[model samples]
Target: MRAVAALARRSVRAGSGRFLVEGPQGVRELVRYAAPSVVDLYVTAAAAQRYAALVESASAAGVFVHSVSDEVLAAMADAETPQGMLAVAQQPEPTLADVLAASPRLLVFLQEVRDPGNLGTVIRAADASGADAVLVTDSSVDVFSPKVVRSTAGSLFHLPVVTGLDAEATLAEVASHGIRTLATEGEAALTLPHVDLAGRHCWVLGTEAQGLPDHLAAACAERVSIPIYGKAESLNLAMAATICLYASAAAQHGTQ
Candidate 1:
């Protein structure tokens, strides 16, 4: 138990790069998708009694289940609800090359997006919208933070998320890949619906408070805005990113 707790806190776990996964839903997904890498599965004694099916499933999958005391479980949990089960599994490494390898054609670059919910929502949207991967530049929240992971609601397992990108290098790399970058601004000439987001594109979303950085904006192939006839000053970063990514998807898929 102590070792499991230590592993959860540390960044490294053998060569697998494991991280702790909490909650019933997350554990279930982990067992289904990453069963082999699951090291220790913990459940409170009461929880074990209540969630017999989950316990059985983990046990059948060769996951070691511990009926920990409530206090022990609480101490290990990052959330308040402490969903009966947690797993330690490998954290897949995603790189720019890997992302491009998946789909060299289109991608989304999230610049300085500080909110975990926003970051996770964008990742989920990227997955659903068929984006290659999400490049999180410096100034964003940690992609693997608990809140971000929870916000993803299991989409974290499906999508590739590359973080810690140097803005200039990222722009250069995307440009080299033939990705035409687009930035969202309040005062852009073209609106999102009018842009030709057909091929090899990178839709860049900016910070919530401030839009894209000047250098990054300059790096873009074009600047576009989401025409808002409503009274709101600006749309939320995640909503705007979703609209932009979907627009690109629509153009690429010929659904526009």
Candidate 2:
């Protein structure tokens, strides 16, 4: 139980090549999408009953499903209030070559993004917007962290996320795939609507506080800014990323 709870720590997850998936939503998706990676599933009796279909799916995948007491579930979960279900799953290994090989039309490149919630929200938005993949630099937060995985709300398992990349080299490689790279900046002369998003492109986003550094912005083919109409100081990083991704989605689908 102590070892299971220790999975919440990044060092433990890294060393073990495993991470915890909490709640019904995350566990359900993990079973449905990445079932082969599931190692052990722990659930309370009530959760097993409530999420019977889910448990059945996990069992069918040959996952070890353990029904433990509520106290045990609490000890194994990372959430303040245990969601009654949790799972230990192996981490996925995706590469940049894999992403490029898919001929991705639209993509997102996150540079040094530090906030776990913001990173998770951006990943969820990318999935919702039909992004081919999410390329994350090593400077960013661990996408497999409990906060990030939970915040993704199961979108984490929906799409491919290639991590541990060098920011500049990644941008160049994606560009080599014939995808235009657009940096999201507050002061860019080009606004969102003016940019041609109907074609293959990648949106490069920055950190929560500092945003993209000048050199990273220069590396991209273009820079864009999301206009603020109201008195608000600025848009949140996740909200900005959502707007950017959805814009490309709309353009690609001819809905814009």
Candidate 3:
């Protein structure tokens, strides 16, 4: 449908409170984790046959499934290889309270990141590292963007990704909950391992270019750096999130 294709634009997806997800993996994950949120599923006839169990599972869950022409599916998809399947689903809604209720011990925040690929990768890293949730602050890429959804592969459905938040307020609130807020600043003297991660912690990462605003970084409990043993210039957003999150995870799990 032309309407589904139009969802490739961030404004359109936001205006409609809906988003389109491509690939069978994302669709299958949606069915498994959040079936009630699915609005409709569109599949090429061949995809319907290839991924018959997914079609059956979605249908059994009461999600509307349509097997259309390959051309129609192509129109609905944004990926170069569309997996011949696409799905429209309501955007996930998770409030700050919802995030806190999960008893989050470790958290990650992206402050004003612009790249959808980076955002999605950070989300996937968060899920793999067993983070409770991820927060994308103001000026960040829209999490529902098709590019972001595609980059997430399926982790977007695995964890709660809180978006469109005020970086200052959210960090303040997280700090109020007795969590140590550590902003990743390359120039900082404290190393990631120097921090006491055995307690609750929240790692705040900045943009690729500007990093965090100076005042925001100052507001955190401490600013730390991931020690670079090699001659690399710096770690990208995804690598930083992955390293910081897993550090906490290892500290928590290994000690147990």
lDDT of 3 at 136: 86
lDDT of 2 by residue, 1-256 (tens): 8999999999998899999999999999999999999989999999999989999989999999999999999988889765799999999988999999989999999998899999999999999999999999998899999999999999989999998999999998999989999999998889999999989999999988888999999999999999988998779899999999999999999853
Question: Lowest-lDDT window of 10 residues in candidate 3?
Answer: 247-256
Candidates sorted by lDDT, best first: 2, 3, 1
**Root mean square deviation (Cα) for candidate 3:** 1.2
- Per-residue lDDT of 1-256 in model 3, one digit per residue for the tens? 9999999988898899999889999999989999999999998888989999999999999999988898888878888788889999999999877998777988898898898899989888888888889988868889998889988889999989998899999999999888889999999999988888888888999999888889999999999999999999899888888888888888988954
Cα lDDT, model 2, residue 26: 96
Q: How many backbone clashes does candidate 2 have?
A: 0
Best by lDDT: 2
Which of the two, 2 or 3, has more lDDT? 2
Which candidate comes out best when scored by TM-score? 2
- lDDT of all the models against the reference? 0.79, 0.93, 0.90
TM-score of each: 0.86, 0.98, 0.97
Clashes of each: 0, 0, 0
